[model samples]
Target: MTRVFITDDHTMVRRGLRTLLEELSGFTFVGEAGDGATLLAQLHHQQVDLLLLDISMPRLDGYSALVSIKKEWPELKVCVLTMHEEPYFIRKMLQVGADGYLIKNCPREEIVKALETLAEGKQYYPAEVSQLIMQDLVNGTPKVPLTRREKEVLKLLVMEKTTAEIAEDLNLSTHTVDSHRKNMLQKLECKTTVGLIIYALEHGLG
Candidate 1:
């Protein structure tokens, strides 16, 4: 059986994960932790084949925890399950040695697939993540000439920030923000916000 551990701050989220993991075949729920400190401490005494980690935690955030865990337990497989879908976050986690990256909103089957892939000693990047990589490969170099401000807007869009929120944060008028967005769309040949987001991810601009 694959001995898996979970680390999430919320009790309910942990419980839900435990329940779902238990129902899956060939998986043994070894333990869980509410924070990164507890997880690091418990890992010293436990034999975990896989770790399902959340990015936002109370004591220690996922990035720090991942670095420490990878340093100490280099052979351990970590799968990041988080609500963050930004390209930057995804790239950072993979660079930190996470074996898999799955958005929290991904379907339940994807969770099982990720675990199984990890158990088989293979890396798993969800469809969304893979799409970014493929786009980068196909584009070769980012040909579309984008201004600095336009790039910032694209990054914010990839992070799911609304136009008004981005405008306020960037201290730009709403009309100006809209103009930038429209210009980016035209330059990138994208018809929607999602396409712009994909372009940003493809170029690792976010």
Candidate 2:
């Protein structure tokens, strides 16, 4: 069974999720928390395979919590459960290493599927989230074109490859990989690697 924990500010939301997980076949609702700090603290002593995290909360927000989670527990699977459908939020979560993303209003079946997908060590983003990403790309296409090599690097970046891994895969020096990343940022008018990834996803480069 997939050991699961929930972190949300709303009691009703947590209760509802708990009930759902209890009824599900492949999941075990290990615990729940009202905020990120408590969740992190519990994680230290609990055995959790998946985390259903809310983006907005008191004290420690989801973004901050997620960064800490990824840094401290790299193997933990996090599926962001939020009401926000904005591209910025989704991109930020993706950049922060969320394993999956789900809107609060999404059907329960989708949530089940997302959790199952994460349990199987895969990423999940429903069609609505994907549409939003594509729409963002349509609205914000950069004028400058990328070289073939740049496109290859961008693709690997989207796949969450590190600089060294990318270099090894492409048979290039880490310096060359970094240079390509910098070039892509400048060409795409993006300030960060996450921006490049978002752009690449929007443009179907991923």
Instruction: State TM-scores per candidate.
Output: 0.66, 0.65
Question: Model 2 off-target regions past 4 Å?
Answer: 132-206
Candidate 2 at 25: error in angstroms?
1.1
- What local distance difference test score does each model get? 0.88, 0.91
Clashes of 2: 0
The alpha-carbon root-mean-square deviation between model 2 and the true structure, to one decimal in Å, is 12.7
Q: After superposition, how far is residue 57 of candidate 1 from its true place, in Å?
A: 0.7
| lDDT string, candidate 2, 1-206, tens digits | 99999999999999999999999898999999999999989999999999999999998889889999999999999999999887667877877799899999999999989988999999898987777668767886324678999999999999999999999999999999999999887556588999999999999999
Candidate 2, position 150, lDDT? 98
**Which segments of candidate 1 are over 4 A away from where they belong?**
135-206
Give lDDT: candidate 1, residue 18.
Answer: 93
Error of 1 at 52 (Å): 0.2
Best by TM-score: 1
